[model samples]
Structure formats: C-alpha cells, structure tokens
Target: MKQGFVKVAAATPDIRVADVWHNCEEIRKLLSEAEKEGAKVIVFPELCLTGYTCQDLFTQDILLKEARRALERIAQQTKNSGSLVFVGMPLAVDGELYNVAAALNDGRILGFTTKTFLTNYGEFYEMRQFRQGPEKARVISYEGQEIWFGPQLLYQAEEMNELIVSAEICEDVWSPVPPSIQAAREGAVILVNCSASDETVGKDSYRQELIKGQSARLMAGYVYANAGDGESTTDLVFGGHNIIAENGTILKEARRFTNEMIISEIDISRMLGERRKNTTFQTAKERNLPRISFTVNLEETRLTRRFGANPFVPQNMEERAKRCEEILMIQAMGLKKRLLHTNSKTAVVGISGGLDSTLALLVTAKAFDMAGKKRKDIIAVTMPCFGTTDRTYHNACLMSEKLGATLREVPIADAVRTHFRDIGHDEDVHDVTYENAQARERTQVLMDIANQEMGMVIGTGDMSELALGWATYNGDHMSMYGVNASVPKTLVIHLVKYYADTCEDAELRAVLLDVLDTPVSPELLPPKDGEIAQKTEDLVGPYELHDFYLYYVLRFGFEPGKIYRLAKIAFEEQYDDETILKWLRTFYRRFFTQQFKRSCLPDGPKIGTVALSPRGDWRMPSDACAAVWMKDLENLTFNKTGGYSL
Candidate 1:
C-alpha cells in the first residue's frame, strides 16, 4: 500500500451453534466481500466456527474434530484470496483445550495465537472448558500441520516493514496489563482481538472506551471483531459490536445486532511517528519471541477514510463546548499562576474587539476572578488610529465596561502623525511602514500602561497568526504572557461564542455576540465609505484553510502532496481545487517566511496538541529555506484548463 496506508476490516458473520459447515460458508462469503473491497487484513469474531452459545458443547470431541476440518477447509478457501485473515476456533493440544485465532494467508496457516486470559467469572464459563493458554513460545501439531502456537506470536508483512500485527482474545484487553502492551513493545503496530463480548446496560460504552484506551496506550491500530446476533442468548445478548481504531481515534464502528463488516484504512506511518516522538514510550530490547512473516501483493490501497477539515476543533456541539471550557480554564490557570508568582495587582490587555484580543481579555478577567481580585483591576486599553471604526471602538469600550473592567482609550492619531513627520514619510501613502507604525505604537502604549499600573501585558495573537507570521515584530507579537497563543483562529470563533452563551450577564453577552459578528481585521488602513477596508483574510488566505494546513504540517509531519490530497477530500464541497491550491501555496510561503517571529514567541500556555510555542511543542529554525516545499508545489501539474491535473 502506498503511504503506508493498509486497508483493514473487522467482520461479524452469522453463526449457528455446532454447525461448522454453515459457519464456514458464512466466513467464506464475508472473506470474499472483504477481499473484493481490497482489505489486506480481516478479522472474524471469537468462537464463530462453533458459536459462543455452544457452552457445554465445547467439550464434545465431535465438534472439535469437525472444527479442525472446517478450519482446514477455511484455509483452503483463502488460498486464492489476497488478505491475511484471522479466524476463531477451538483447539486441543496434549489433552489441553485452548481458544485460539488462526492466522491464514495464501494456502496455509501462518501461526496460531492463543487467548492469554480466559473469562470464567460472572456470565462467562470459558475456564470451565478451556485452560489458560501457554504464555511462552511453543510449536504444536494440528490438522497435520506444525503451527507456531503461543500468546507472544507476531505476524509481520513481507513488503511493508511497519505492518507488524499481534492478537489476543476478548478478555485479554480487560486485564490490568494487556498482552497488546507487550506485543507493541515487541514492535507490533497493529493489534487484533477475536472477541465474544455480550451486551449489558452500559457495557457497550465501557467496551468502546476500553478498546480506545488500549489502542491509545499501545500506540497501535486495534481491530476488534465481536460475536454478534445469532449467538445464543441463554444469559447474555451478543450485540456484534465491531470496531477499528488507531491511536485513540475510532476510525470505523459497526452497529449492534448486525452481521456486517467495518472497514477503514490504517496509517501505519503516523503511529510509528507518534511512537518515535514519545521517548517515554519504552520498548523491550529483546523480546526473544518468534515472528511469522507473510507476503501480500504490494498494491495501492484506495482510501475511504474521511479526514476532518478542522482537526483542532470538534464538530459536535456538546464536545466543542466542553473543549472550549477546558481550554479556557487552562489558559486562565496559566495566567493566574503567573500573576500569583509575580504578585501583580493588575493585568493590561489591548482590546481590539477582534476574536483573539477579545478572548485574551476574557481569560484575563477569569484569571483575576480566580485570584480573588476585582475585575476592575484588569485594565483594558483601546488605541484608535487612522483605521479606527465606530463599530469596533464602541464594542471595545462596551465589552470592557460590561465585564466590570477599567477601560482606557488612548487616541494615537496625533502620536502617529508626529512620528510620521519625524521619519519624513508621506501622510497620504499607506504602506507596511504605515501599518506597522500603528501596531508598534499600540504595543508601546500597552507596555507603558502595564508598567505604570504594576501589571503584565497580555498578548492577543493566536496560533494561526503565528503560523503565518502575521504579527508585527516587537509590536502586538510581544507580550508578558500570551493566553491565546496556542489557540487557532477557527477554534477561537467557537470559544468566543461559547463564552457568550454561557456568561449569564446580559450586557456582556450582547457585546460578545456583536464581536463575533465583526469581520476579522487589523484596522491599520483608513476606512472606505466609513466601513473597515483592511481585512486580514483578503490579504492572506482564509484562517480556516491556514489552520487546516497548520494542523497536518505540525501535528503529523505530512508532506505537502499528502496534505493537499486530504484537504481536497475534506473541503471538496466548501472549496474548489484551484482555490485550495492557491491558498495552500500562500500558507506554505507565509508559514516558512514567518518562522523568525515564532522563534522568539512570548510565554503562552500550550492549550492543545498542536502549538507553535517556541518553548514547547515546536522548534524550527527562523532562517530555514522553503525551497524543498516550494519544489514539491512546483512539481504539482496543472491541466490546460487551469485545474490540478490530479
């Protein structure tokens, strides 16, 4: 598979108790479908050959003999299939009965991975029939074949080096220390479970959490195939819940009471990268276990997995609200710690009525409240220059007053004009110097005011701005502590709206709602027809697009081409191919050129997984060349009609 993406499936096929022939046919049908879907790895539920309801029937020698024959036939059925398949069955070795998952690929059995932990308590009577499987590596003869049988067996793909797989039973993952952990430590990037878990009042949710936590802890892709409908319901009901997860994110899940297959593409490279970054995730030096290597035809896997356009922000409303609250609390707590440690009596913030500054002011008020200080101690400064509008200026003053903070307005028109005259710059000319002059003047005012009032200046620049280096050096970019530093522009909108809905003060809510409606702008240039003309998105690309670019680039280390492909899929309906490419190029150019400003970023709390804080999460050279990235973009071919050739 190209880009280390392997298509995998978890299937729950219909089963009948002690009916090996019928079950084998069902398995064959599902296997055929999966192979047709281009699945390289497919897993079936536990004890599917002889249904889990076959309780005491598991002790019968006739069923065992038939199951062995059925397994051989199943292996033969997959001789022409391309996938590496795992099937559950009962096996007896030296008079000891064991539950195992047989790994089959091409015409023969690769190995047998026994269930390490047997569920015997409560509703399960697995221990009544089968004993705990052998923990050490061992070989056993079954069906006239010597299969490597043990709990520490790992199956590796011949062509792809990262596709190392291991397996355990249903209850093994519930153990205090799962075998998956040791298997991962032995370099298994994918874990499979042949599970027959029954459903209860809240067990489904708990089971989902268990699988997600285990996958995250092991840093491996987990495929859980559970016994579903048709399993005997003597004491428990099987829901047939199958899941495919990777690194804590559930990629695909099946509905309960359904005999269906859940398929998704696994990015093995991303998991390996995560493991390599986390030094504390230690591995064993020498596992001293046997590895069974098999070959699957090397072919490109067509991905059907969906990548969210906005990875930093949750799409669900309730989840987004919860995340916003958590991030806000973290920001406030960070500021509170600094205030307490410094023994400062006040916090100085520049109120621009923009999303980032508004959030900074909100966090400052929260920090003051947390420190048991009056909100009046938070000094909100508004500096109006040539580009000042009645709407933003009024909103800035109103927000400060409604929040019970002390508001101070310093008009910088005369100060800037005097400075412009001193520098011999034309008053009518609007250039970088004209705009940066206003930004530096505002920062100078805030810094001096903070010194005068015995407080610290809170920065309002967000992660998106920092990524594109859209801040004036030593201007709005510098602060005593940047509460919104790690937060991105797309998430900032929701955070502000979340505060507006939750903050009960009616006047404060009204001001916040208006601020959310205002267009994002620096307001450095004069107004056109008394309306703001200096829009940030028009000069740069959209913040939504830039934030998307920032996440894949910093979080997963994806190359330009891969990110472009994913972005095209995620934003297909919202944006066109040409528009995406145009902004994408802008994003790369600005992101590379703006690293100098980020190299010396101010102290800010890291609020999420992706951050541009120079002190944490990111460390890039300021002068690094963008030639390699640009070359990749240049190599992207365009059609005669101007669209991407792809």
Candidate 2:
C-alpha cells in the first residue's frame, strides 16, 4: 500500500441463479479487474458464489457442493493475485447450514464471517434454509480444512499493520446494533458488507445514508457490495449499489442497475488514529465478544482516491451554502450565550474592511439581534494606525453605518509613534513591533470602548490565525468571546462569498464581493498604489496549506510525512513539489512552536473537527518539542523521489 492507504473494492459480478461454475468465472473476472486497479482487498456481494435469489434451489445438494468447490477454486485463482478477498455463500458447520462471507487469502480459506442477523421480513426467507450463525467463533473442519468462523472475526494485515478488514452480511447492517460496529471498534479499519438488498423506490438513498452513517458512527472505512443485475428476478430485482466510504463521507459509488465496481483508497492510519482518540470506541472493543482470528499479508496497493485542495469548504454550491449557514449560526450562538450569561448590553468589534473582522462583525450583529437588542448598541470601532489606507478606513465606516451599528474611529498613529520612541524602536524600520503595534492598538481601542460601553470585545481572529499563531499574544488573541475562533482561513473566504450570494442589497453585496476579493492583510504598512502593502500569505505562507496541515494533524492525528504526502496530491495543480515541501516545513515549525499560544487560548466554540482551544479540542503542553515531527518532515524532502507516478 502507498503510505498507509489500502485500496479496496466493492464489486458486483454478473450472476445466474444456481449456476455456481458460471458465477465463479464472473467472480474471477471482477477480482482480476479489482487487482489491476490496485485494490488490496476485494469483496463480492452476498451469495455471489450462487446467486442470492436461488431461493429453494439453495437446498439442492449439488449446488451447495459446487459452491464450496467454487470457493476453493476462486481462492486458488487469487493466490498469486496477492489481495485478500471476501465471497459470500452457504457453509455447513456442525451439520447446520449458515450464510457466510468466506474470507480467502493465498489460496486458502483464512476464515469465514457468518451473518449475525437473518432477515425474515418482506422479501428475505434465509431463515427457512439457513440457521442464524454463531456470535462467537470456533475452529470447524469443512471439506478436510479447518477454518475459524464466526461474527467476531478480525482480518489483520501483516504487511500494512494499520490496515484491518472485517465483514458482515446484508441484514446484519440493518440491525439496531451491527456487527461491523463492534468489528470496527476491535481495530478493523475497514468494514466490508456483503449484501443482497433488492431494489425498490428510494431504497438507494436509504442505502447510501446507511453506508455513510455507518462509517461515521464507526469512524472507519466501509465498503458495501450488494447483489447486482442478472440475479434471478423471481420476485425481486437487485440493482447493485456498490459504495466505498471513509469516515462518513462517500468517496466513490457505482451507479445502480449497472454491473460496476466501486473502488477507493482509504487512509488506514487516519481511521486508526480516530479510533484511538475516541475513548468510547476503544472501550466498546474491550467489552464486545473477543475478536476472532484471520490474518493476511496486505498486498502493496497504490492510492487512487484524490484528496481535495480545500478540505474546510465543500465544493458543491448548495451544500456549501448550507454549511456556511450552519457555521454562521454556530458562531452567532456561541457569542449569544456568552453575551446572555454575562448580561452584556452591547458587543464592541473593530471593523477593518478585512474578511476576518467582517465575519466577526456580521456574527456579532446576529448575536445582538437574537438577544432582542438594537443593532445600534453594537459599538463598531475603527482604529486606523500609521499604515491605514483611506479605502479600508472609509469601507469600515460605511459598513458600520450600513449595518446600523455605532461607528467610532480611533486613529492611533501618534500614540503608537510615542510608544515606539519610548521603546527605542526605529520608526523607519517597521518590523514585528511595527506590525504588532497596529494590531494591539486596534485591540486596545475596542477593549476600552467595550469597557466604557458595557459591552464585550468580540474577537475578529479566525481559526487560521490561531492555528499558525499569527496573531500577536495579548493583542488580537485576547477577547471577551471569539466568534470565528474555530473557522479556518480557507473557509473565511467562502463565508464572505456566501453572504454576498444571499445579500438583498446590490451595494452591500458589491462591498462584500470586494472584501472577498481583497488579499488577506492587516493593512498595517503604507499602501502601495492604494492597495494592501502587508499581505499575510507572503509572510507566513498560505493559510490553505497551513489549514490543511492543521486539519490532518489535529483532527486525524496524522504524522507529518502522511500529511505532506496528501497535500501534494490535493494541491498538485497549484503548488509545485519543492514549493509544497518548503511550505510544509514552515507549517510544521510554526504549528509546533505555536503550542504556547494555543495552550492559553481564549474561550471559543469549536465549529469543526479541527480546533485549537486549549481546554477543549487541544490540550498539548506549551513546552512540547517539535524535533520528532520536524525530523520526519525533513526526511520527506531528502527522499523527494516519491510520487513520481502521475
């Protein structure tokens, strides 16, 4: 597998009722196709060895025996193919027939996972011919081969240690408690389901939701292979809705009614890390019936799934709008609670014509409105320093008036010059002090106004600034409440665009679109031809890359090398290899060093999986060293020959 990715497939092969030999040929063809696509693990639909719709024909002795022989032949055919494969059929154990997903690896039956729940409702009549399988496992001799079989089996990969595969049947997943849930809890990073769900109206949507929700609930990779076309249409039709999902998101899905294979490369390490962090998942594993044994040497598989450049924002417009609205509500509700509890009469925010400040101001307006207070009670302060441009100053004033908030401008050029003189800082040489002075002055003005007006100084810094520790300590970092504290810099742009899209007033929308277009800057240096002179990305690297690193690091707990690998794929069109590497190095250094800033972070609401709130999402010690993480990242640059394959 490439890095920790294990390419897996959920396939539905053409089948004929009660024709085990013909079915085996179809299985071989599909399996070979999956192996060619670098799928390390492959799954066929339930009763694929003999079509699920075989019905009473399932009682035929010759058909059952041929199904067993077909299983053996398929295992032998895939011995050299290197992938671990799952095929469903009937297995007789202790003189009782049980529906089973037979696990095969290297020409042998590694084990068999029996269906935990049998459906007798509506269309299923498996109970008439097959007994419900054992919940616990035991070695059983079948056709002179002893194999472990049960619902508790866990297929561990020796080659890819992080990769684990486990299986359950169709009805098992529909139960209140699915066996895959416990299987996932038991360290199986991927849960495969061999299903024979018949087609019905709106069934695909429900199936899609089930697969996605199961992945989310288990926090693991899920591959669902349902019965396909060509199954005996005696009373039901199965439109193969094969799916592959990771962590609740569908990565790939095959169109129903077509004989298709769904393939996806899942990050086993990420799923493993997620399971590690969730105490409940680990605890569930401990108490659930002991895990049964099935081991496979994971064949080396290449990744085919493409990661997104912007992980924070959705690509779909309708979904993006919904997400934007949800995020805005989260920010507003968080501020509203703080305001209500503190009994603050007003909220004071510095309006900078910049995106971060604009979003914070927008959220503040909503919070006040929800609290049944007048928008005028919001003290919107504009503090211009030495480098302030007329454009931003006027825009800030205009925004305050249009939003119906109290507009107050406090220019701090002379006061900051006096402070610089006191501190022996050269006014001509504008450096850290020069930049931080403006931010602190702006914060100071808002704080004093908030105090005087009996209001809260709502923080304007978003999650991105907090992640890279770009904001000055005790400057923009301190506030009564942070509205956009959990929002990433990448998402901030989309939120502005979302507001622009929804604005009723063309003039206000025009201003918002311009604000969205504006390069993120503090406007703390003299304007160059009436434009921003101090762009943030030029100094600290792109927030896109930093936010990418932060999400994988904090949310998935991915190693530096893994994050670097995925980033290259996500931003291949935008950033060259060396440029991405350089920025990745910078991200690791800043993120680890900035733990001190995050360790004492002010109160904020966590809107996403990635958050740096000291007391909540993040609890790392400020003094923790970055040496190990840096060294790993540096190693990637040295061995830069990887990812040469297009």
TM-score, every prediction:
0.96, 0.95
* Candidate 2 Cα RMSD after full superposition onto the native fold (Å): 2.2
Clashing pairs in 2: 1-300
The segments of candidate 2 whose C-alpha lies over 4 angstroms from its true place after superposition are: 284-300, 637-646
Question: What local lDDT score does residue 143 receive in model 1, on the 0 to 100 scale?
Answer: 68
Q: Against the unseen true structure, what C-alpha lDDT does each candidate score?
A: 0.90, 0.84
Report residue 223 deviation for candidate 2 (angstroms): 1.5
lDDT (C-alpha) at residue 206 in model 1 = 95
For residues 215-251, could you state the per-residue lDDT of candidate 2 as single tens digits?
9888888999999898988789899999999989999
Q: Native-vs-model 2 lDDT? A: 0.84
Q: Pick the candidate with the highest TM-score.
A: 1
The TM-score measured for candidate 2 stands at: 0.95
Report residue 14 deviation for candidate 1 (angstroms): 0.9
Clashing residue pairs, backbone N/CA/C < 3 A, model 1:
228-240
